[model samples]
Target: MSSGLPAGVDLTNTLLILGGVGLVTLLLRALPFAAMRYFRESALVAWLGIAMPAGVMTVLVMYTLVNSTENPGGIGAALIAVVATAALHLWRRSATMSILFGTVIYMLLVNLVF
Candidate 1:
């Protein structure tokens, strides 16, 4: 059977291009996992696994604090939420309670302030 592609688009060339792309995609994804296998027993990898997530969380929290004031009453609500979260954590040392309290406080503050 003849290739169904439009004129000038050779079937063999199209297959080669698709195969190259698939190989590159597979290598790109597998390279990182292969590198991780080498570092499976290393202290650096262990520390990085822990520290990277903590660093990401800290950056996200700071970003939210900084950007919360873009709309009306957002700043005050965020402030209240942060304070409430802190207070809950301080009192009970419970992350779940702190998050719950913080969310409620934030909602209340937003409704009242805006």
Candidate 2:
């Protein structure tokens, strides 16, 4: 079967492409930690350290809710999971607990009820 890749894009090129992507991703992930020492005392960095997690979580929740609408049947389960997650977070103030329970709830609902 044909791969449909452009001519000249063979295994070597694919490996190189993947390696480049992996290197870029690794660097991107490590860049923030690497720069943290330099920005340790900066006010902006301090504020971001406190704020970025909430901002990122908000973005993720919005993305999940928006995407859930695309699958009509699963919307209820998604909403329930989000609500349960938020409530758990508010109640227990544990990120790990909230996320784990929320995921388990979502999976169960999707698999069994939805």
Candidate 3:
């Protein structure tokens, strides 16, 4: 057992610090909901509600595209899928068909070419 932690370190003394940090995190996460109750008609809240989801989606898409090219054949397969998706979307104006077609094309390309 350790009598006391090294300099600048103490698990026993850090419990309260950790708890305070956790509490702050919880409060920050809950702040948007709390603000909604008090300022339901605030333009800032309304704008954030709309923009946040769009921003999240943009980030997710960028992350996916960035992480998808680890393998040698990934770029070609992704290109085929994107082209198929775009074609389906343009020709039929159907998001479901576009996604389905893209997935199928991607799988087929990966299996056959790579």
Question: Best candidate, TM-score-wise?
Answer: 2
Candidate 3, TM-score vs. the true structure?
A: 0.45
Two-way TM-score contest, 2 vs 3, winner = 2
Give the 10-residue window scoring lowest on summed lDDT in candidate 2.
Answer: 66-75
Tell me how many residue pairs clash in candidate 3.
0
Off by over 4 Å in 1: 1-8, 71-73, 76-114
lDDT of each: 0.80, 0.87, 0.75
The ten-residue window of minimal lDDT in model 3 covers 56-65
lDDT tens digits, residues 1-114, model 2? Answer: 457878777877888999999999999999999998999899998899899988988898888788887764467988999999999999999988998999899888878887
lDDT for each residue of candidate 1 in 1-114, tens digit (9 for 90 to 100): 677799889999999999999999999999999898789999988999879855864675577689887855677777777877888888998867776788777777777766
lDDT by residue (3-43, candidate 3, tens digit) is: 57687788866888999999999999999888778788889
Better of 1 and 3 by lDDT: 1
Per-model C-alpha RMSD? 5.4, 5.0, 6.0
Give lDDT for model 2: 0.87
Q: Top lDDT: which candidate number?
A: 2
